[model samples]
Each structure stands twice: as C-alpha cells, then as structure tokens.
Target: MKGHRGSILDIAVVADGQNVISSGQDGTARLWDSAQGACIAVVDDSYSPINAIAVAEVGNAVNLGSPKETPSNREVGTEGKLVVLAREDKSLEGVSLHSRQSVFDFEGSDAFNCCTFISSVGVLAGGLDGNIIHVDITNPKSAVETVSWSETPVLSLVPFRDTYVASYGNGTCYIPLKGSEQVLQLTGPNRQPVFQVAAWKKLVYTCCRDGFIRKYEIPDLG
Candidate 1:
C-alpha cells in the first residue's frame, strides 16, 4: 500500500468492499486491504506511470491469454473480475483480480487518460490525443478501432446504457450512440473543461472546471 513513488491516480473498491486496487504515477498497480490498510499484492509494474483504473466483472469474457507480467505471490485472490489500468505509456493493461496475472497489455494511439468497461467482452480507453480506443477482450490482439471528434485530450469515459458519454479537455461532453455513430454535445453554461460525467435515470450530470455541476435531460436514454 505504500510502494508508489508518485501520486496514486485512482483507486477502486472491490465488489465485496473489503479490498481496493490502485494505479499510480509510480508505475505500479497495487491491491490493498480497505479496512486494515495493508498491501495485499503488487498486481503489476509497467515502469510507466498509470493514470486511471477501472474494475469490471468480466467472467469468461476475458481471453486470459499469455501473461505479460504475473504477480510474485498469490495472497490476493481473483474475484471473477479484471482490473484495467490506463497508463502514461499509451498502454492499457488488464489483470485478473484474484490470480493477479496479466490478462492483456494493449497500446493505444496516445497515452490513455481514462478507461471503462463497455461490456463483458469489450473495453474502452480514451487517450491524450482525443481518441476513444475500443478493445475486444476476447480478441484483444486484433486491430483496435478508434473514435475521435476533436484534437483535445479526452478526460473521461462514462458508460451510459448502450453507449458511452465522454468528456474532453476542450470542455465538450459527447454522447456517441452505439449503432448510429451520432454524437450529441451536452451544452453547459461555459466552455470550461468538463472533468467527469454521471447519469441517473434519464438525467446526465457533468462536473466542470467552471466550478459548477451541470445537468442535462436525456429523454430517450432511459
């Protein structure tokens, strides 16, 4: 729990709420005991700073191909989930929760700033170059597809039903429809960068640099 040489970028609690996983700018992904504040395992070390982490219950959808890096010990158990790390090296890493084994390490168009699980078999990462890279976990080595609307860095990726709501450094919030490829912008009071997004029922909310939380009504996304 104390190994990161740089700032810890993100931390995710397990479904059981007893454990947490963290990614840091120090280039290590660590597992920790939430209650005891003990380090359980060092999940991976890429020698490159990690920017974000997301936990998803992937089950059998992950390919679990040849591990690129495996944990040194087995004290941390696998939890029928995978830990995805967004790294500054332009790579996205997936490691099994319990086994602490590498599931995959995928490089993207630019350093990834954020990532999220789109489905059981699919993952999405947004990069500094404004590209949203999609990965099929079951066929991870295949050519990855990208989506971009501008040249500004992507700051966040939030899953919303069948599509994803992404935010950019240029203060734009985009909701890209899955099939239609239609992009809808959520207008705010100003152009200050939208940092993150959350949705409840048919309403979408975004936090911005303008020191305001903006809300948008999505009548059809319910």
Candidate 2:
C-alpha cells in the first residue's frame, strides 16, 4: 500500500479477492488488504526493481512440496495461492501466499519483463533476453521449457485457449502452435510496443503504445 518507495509496476488480486499483491520499482513485492486499504506485509524484496506480478491458486493435483517450517499467522490465509514476481534482477520467484515461503526461485538468461500462470502450478515468464521460460511449479526439479521468436524482449503473455499469445517490445504479437515450430503473427498495428493483453470468449484484445486498442477474433480452440 503506502510502503513502496517507488512506482508500482504491476498488481494482482488474490483469488480470495480480499487481498492484492504489488510489484514495484522500489524492488519489493507487497501484500495488502484490499477492503481496509492497508499494507498487510512485504512479501519479498530484490535489490533491483520488479516488473510484473501474478497470482494463481494451485489445485490439489500439483505437488509443491512441504513447507520448510510452520507458517506464521500472517501467512495462514495463503495456503493454496502463489504470488509470482518478474524482477529486473533476472529472476522469477514464486512465494506462497499463506506461508510467505519460497515456492521456487529461478534465474533466467536476462531480466524478466512479465509473467503469467498458464495453469495453477504452471508459470510462464518472459525475459529481456528474448526467452520465454515455462516452469512446472508442482515439480521443484522440473526442467524449464524455453521458447523464443526473436531477439526482442517479451512484454506480455495472455492465455488463449490451449495455446498462449505473446507480445514483444519489437511491436509483434504471435501465437505459437503445438506440434509444430511455427509461430503465427497477428497482422496490423505498426511497430508500436504492445504492453498489455486480455481475452474474452473467442476474441483477444491488445493495447499498444500507438494509442490504439487492437482486437482479434480467435477461431474455435477445438
């Protein structure tokens, strides 16, 4: 809430809807009570700035391993949720919402610019080094899957059906198909960085720096 010393870059509301987590340029990730508009606690801190934050509720199917020790009173409510932060320190860290413990801390090839959860225990983080790393949080020793389309930094990732759509700093948005190495680039919108993306039903929307909101219709996922 009022504790961040710099600009807040991203914020995600917990599944319970009562709390919100924020990543800031001040190099800290904080948890806040939404209803009371108060800072509950500082979730994590990196010496460098954090660019994005995402929250996901891990279902029973995933094995996130046992906590190192008992959770404190402040961490009791976050048992099933994970707060993920994309940091300028070239790392992607997942923290347990309730226990305030580290689920996994991974270093990437470069600073992570954005991140999203493809599933409860599955995460995707895009880096400035032009790599998108996918992690299976259920398995601590799981091998990370890396995907790359260009040398440009990936700025956003939006889930679309079985696949996901990604936007880059080079002003390109693409969808990578399964069973093939090919990527389909979305047409229109000149070379302007697309910063945010969202989806509804069978349509996808993107907001670009060119001052325009672009919409695209996605075919049946089936």
Candidate 3:
C-alpha cells in the first residue's frame, strides 16, 4: 500500500499493525490505513522536511513479572505515548501521536537529521553538525549532552538492547551504554551513505544508499 508521490523520508508501522505513518520531504506527516492504503490524517509542519519518524508505546511505569518467571514468560503491555521527530528549522521537534500536538521543540546550532527513543533512558538525536544529544522526556526542557563524534554527520540512529548503533557516510559506529569509547565500527560498501539501521533478534541490519540491505551478526560484548 503505497501512495506517496514525493520522496518518503521515513515510515513506521504502528504497534497494533493496523496503520502506517510516513513522513515525507513534502513537509507533511501522514497516517494511512494499512488495509486500504488510504490517507487518514495529515499533520502539516512546513518548517523543514520531516526526515525521521519513531512510534513508541508510552504509559504508566509498571513491571508485571515474577522472579520465578523465565525470560519468555514475561508479558508485554501497552504504553499510550507515540513520539514523532522531525527536522525543522535546522533543529528537531517532537510531538505526541495521541494528541497530534507538539510536546517539545529543541533548537541547536546545526541541522538535526535523526532521532530515536531508547526505551527508558531518553531520546537520542543525531545532528548534521556532528553531535549526538540526549533529551530526557521526563523533563521536557532539559537537553542532556551524552556523547559527541566530530567530523561526522550522523545520518541514522537505531537503539539495540542497551546500546545505540549510528551510521554516517563513511561507516557505522556502535556506542555502548556505559562507555564513552566507540565499541565497533562496521564500514559500509564503498563509503555509501547509510540511510537506516534496525536491530532484530541477534542481528543488526543496515540499509544503505547503494540500494542494499546488509545484515551483520551482533557481537557479544561481554
């Protein structure tokens, strides 16, 4: 189900698998019905092109598991919050999907390219100015400077387990949760731009601008 005429910057499927949300270079974010492939809602933000989109389950903090329960026996519940990030006016803006309203807007000196939600830690943003900023959603007004990698414009960011995997034009860098040093760097094909990265099971996958999706086995950093 595809109807976007302009370039699709980013797309995300809802947790329920009933709808798909897409952000485009046309300065709009659209929610579409997955079954019929029809546009249901259009969020107009003409600040800049919406470069990335992320949907997360938000709800009251609760732990529903017993000590005797095994890893596979845990039950996952729903969180009500959905976070959407956009590249606006050389910065990043975040909004809530439930209210379809702006939650908070962050302005930086450089152009913000991408962002991702890291479970309970915070929101991580990568900038074209070679900086990675972490924002605590619990405190909407604070900008926490987590780590920085100079001379590289981080184009994509994906969180896996407790670490974050970011990609640039030169290669990909893996940042551990507790270490300041880079854990790993996997070079892309011939310096192609890494557009997106995803982590599933025990493997990490990268989609490059060269039109190839490559998968790598995630190493055990023990």
Candidate 4:
C-alpha cells in the first residue's frame, strides 16, 4: 500500500482474492496481501509508466519459463497464472506469476494503454495510436494480428462472451466479432473518451468522460 512512489494506475485481483497486483506511474508492479495491507513483493519493474495490467489463470497453455529457484511461501494461487503489463514505453510484457519470470516482452506501435486476456494463450493490447495488437503466448516472437481504425487513442479493452470490446478516446466503442471481419458499434457518446468497459450477461456498459454510464444490449453473441 505504501511502497509505490507515484500514482497507482491499475490493480488486478489475484485468483485467491487475498492478494492483489498493482501497477503505477512509478514503473513497477507490486503484490500486496489484501487482508493485511502489506506489500509482499515488487513483482515487476520497468523503465516507463505501467498504464494497465491483467491477470489470468493460464492452465498449461504455454511455457512460462522455469524460475531459477522455488517460489516463496508467501506466493499463493499463482501456480499457473500469467500477468500482462501495458506500459507507456510502448512495451507489452508478460510475466509468470508463480515463478516471477518474464515470459515475453513485445513492442507496439505507440504507448500501450490497456491489455486483456481473451483465452488461455491469447492476449490483446491496445495502444495510444488506436492500434490493437494480438499476441499468442505460445509464439510471442510475432503478433497474431494487428488492427487500427479511427486513429484515436484506445482507452480500454475487455473480453466479453465470445468477442472483445474496445473503447477509444473519441468516445467510440466497438465489439470486434470473433472469427469474422464484422464489428458492431455501440452508438451514443460523441467525442468524450470512453475510459472503461464491462460486460454482464448480454449488457455491455461503458464509462465515458462525458459523465454518463451507457449501456448496450446484445441478445445473441453467436
């Protein structure tokens, strides 16, 4: 809680819910014991500000690279987890939670603002130049796909049922359909930046800088 030197950017709850990972403008990520509010470890350090981070339980999807030694007794519910960090230095990095090792480090077009896990081995990162980069954990040497539109800064990205939702600085929200070139638009906000997006059942919600929460309904995702 008191370890970071600058403003905290994003935090992700660990699988056990007792520990959390937080990234900050201080260019580091820290793992904290939620119940005790104690800083357990400095999980990651970078040269630029980390804008966002995501954590997911990756079960045998890809090799996380072996750690030099055994894990500490303090690390819990981190056996097969992966953490992805989006940094202002145009780097999208993956770290193994259990071993605390770097899995992969990728550079994007511009500063990455957000990232999310779509599957066991699939990862998506959105950058300030409106480019979305997709990487697979198995072979991170190259990107699976990269898409750009509108040229506005991508503010947020989230996984829905089948596809993923992305919000932009131009106040636009789009759902990039899975396995198809089709993209559905959520109309409403004009030009205010859409900061966050969430999905519940068939409803998709967007938090906009215009000071309103907008909801869109999608009955069928198939």
* Best-performing candidate as measured by lDDT: 4
Better of 3 and 4 by TM-score: 4
State TM-scores per candidate.
0.89, 0.89, 0.80, 0.95
Residue ranges of candidate 1 with Cα displaced over 4 Å: 63-77
- The candidate scoring highest on TM-score is 4
CA lDDT of every candidate: 0.82, 0.81, 0.67, 0.89
Q: Give the Cα-based TM-score of candidate 4 against the true structure.
A: 0.95
Model 3: pairs clashing at backbone N, Cα or C within 3 Å: 58-79, 58-80, 58-81
lDDT of 2 at 198: 90
Q: Which of candidates 2 and 3 reaches a greater TM-score? A: 2
What candidate 2 gets wrong by more than 4 Å, as runs, is 60-77, 140-143
Alpha-carbon runs more than 4 Å astray in model 3: 1-5, 60-79, 177-182, 210-212
Tens-digit per-residue lDDT, 1-222, candidate 1: 587888999888777677788888889988887777778778788789989998888877765444445543433335578989999998888888776678888878789999988888789899999998999877778545888987899998888878889999999989986567688888873668888888876788999998999888885743
Candidate 3 to truth, TM = 0.80
Count: clashes, candidate 1: 2
How many clashes (backbone N, Cα, C below 3 Å) per candidate? 2, 3, 3, 0
Each candidate: RMSD to true structure?
3.0, 2.6, 8.0, 1.4
Better of 2 and 4 by lDDT: 4
